[model samples]
Target: MQTYPVDIDPEQLIRWLEAKHAASPSVFRITAVRATDERMVPPRGTHLDDLDREDLREIATIATLEIAPAHASEGWLLTVVVEDEVGPRLPDKGALIEDEQTIDLVTFDQEFIRTGRGNASVVAAVEGPEAEKRMARLLHSIEADRHNSGPAKSTD
Candidate 1:
C-alpha cells in the first residue's frame, strides 16, 4: 500500500483475517516491499534544503515480533512467518519485505497505524496470485515512468 492508513484497527484486521482463514486456507503474503520515507514524495517545489529531521527520519523495525501466533492476543503481537533468503533487516526494511512472509493481519495493521507516514511504501500481496500479478503490472508501469525511479503509491 501507499500512504499509511491512519484509522487502521487491529481488531478489525483480526476479524477480516479470521473470516479469510475461515473461508479458505489463504496465507497473507507480502511479495515485494521497498523501504522509503516521507521525503520520497515530498511536497512539490520542495528541495533537500526544505527538509527537516522528521522529513529525513526513517523507522526500521524495533522488533522482529512481539509474541508468537499461538500466544497472540489483542494485548500482544501475533506471528509473522518470514521466509529465508532476504538476509538481515535493513533500516529501509526493503530487505525484510523482499524476503517474503505470511504476516498476521493484526501485526501488519497495527504497524501501519503506529508508523503513520514514517515507513516507506510497501508492496503487500494479500490475495495471493492475483494480487501478485497486479503488483507486477503496477510496478512494471512504474518502471516505465520516465520521471520516477523509486517506489510509489496509488490511492485509487
Candidate 2:
C-alpha cells in the first residue's frame, strides 16, 4: 500500500467544516475545533493581518459550505484520517480514493475526525470545490462500505 502525508491549517479546517454545516443546519453541529497547534492558520495577504476567531469561524464555515445535502444529511464532516492511527470520530476508517497520495482535504464521516493532531486544512486552495467533491465521494463510499460490511464483530 502507498500513502502520503497532508498538511493543513486547523482554523481553515474549522471554517470548511462550519460551511458544510451551514447547508444543513438541522442535522450537523459545530462541536469543537481541536488541534495541538494553538496558533491555527496564520492570517496573511494583501489586506489580511493575522488569524483571529473570525478566521477560525470562516474556515469552519467554508468547510461546512462544501457539504452537499446528500452527505450532510447523513452527518458527514470534513476531516483528515491517517492509516492505523486511533484518533477522533471522523466517520471513515481511512478509505480514501484519490489520484494523489497526499491531498490537502478529505472527507471522513466519523471514524477519522480527530483533534490535538494535524488533520484538517485551514488554508484555502484553488481547487477547493474539486477537493470537496472528491472527499465527499470518499465519505459516501465509507457509508456504503459500512452498509456492505454488515453486522459488527462481537467480543466473546
Candidate 3:
C-alpha cells in the first residue's frame, strides 16, 4: 500500500490510480464531490467530465466512488451512495451501495465527503460489459465528479 499526503489534485489522484491500475487491476475508489443537479439527476449523460466550482455546491456529499477498470482505455465508475437517503435515488427506488471500501478522502478535499456531512451527487459509467451486473453486486453507484487539479471540488 502507498501513502499520500493530505490535499492533492483530483487528477493527480486519478493519475495515481491509473498508474496503480497499470501495475495491477484494482478498483479505484474516490471521494464524492459536491455537484449541481444538472448531471447528478437523470437522464445523466454518458462519460465523466470535470465539475465546476458553482456546480459542485448544489449536489450532495458523502458518497464514495468505486472505480473498477473494465477495459484498458475505459473503466466502470460507480458512485456508491450510502443507504442513507437525502439523495434523489436514480429510480427513486431499488438501488443503494454496500460494503465497498474507499480510500482516505482527505486528499480529495471535499469537506462534506471528508467530514461525512451531506448526501451525494453520483456519476457512474453505465457503459461496457458487466456494468449493470457489477453494479448489481454493489448498488447506488460509486463516484463523485470533482475532476481537474485544484482545491476540493466544492469548498466554501
Best by lDDT: 3
Model 2, 1-156: lDDT tens digits are 112232444434434444444444533333322212112343444244443433431121111112223333332243332223232222334533232222122333232343333234322222344444554453443444432332222111
lDDT of each: 0.32, 0.33, 0.38
Q: lDDT for model 3, on a 0 to 1 scale? A: 0.38
Worst 10 residues of 3 by lDDT: 147-156
Q: TM-score-based ranking, best first?
A: 3, 1, 2
- In candidate 1, position 124 carries an lDDT of 29
TM-score of each: 0.24, 0.22, 0.28
lDDT of 1 by residue, 9-116 (tens): 333333444454444432222222223222133344545454442344332332222221221121112222221222222235343323323444445545543444
Candidate 1 runs further than 4 Å off: 1-14, 27-34, 38-102, 113-156
Clashing pairs in 1: none
lDDT of 3 by residue, 73-132 (tens): 433454434222344333324433333334444433344444445543444564555554
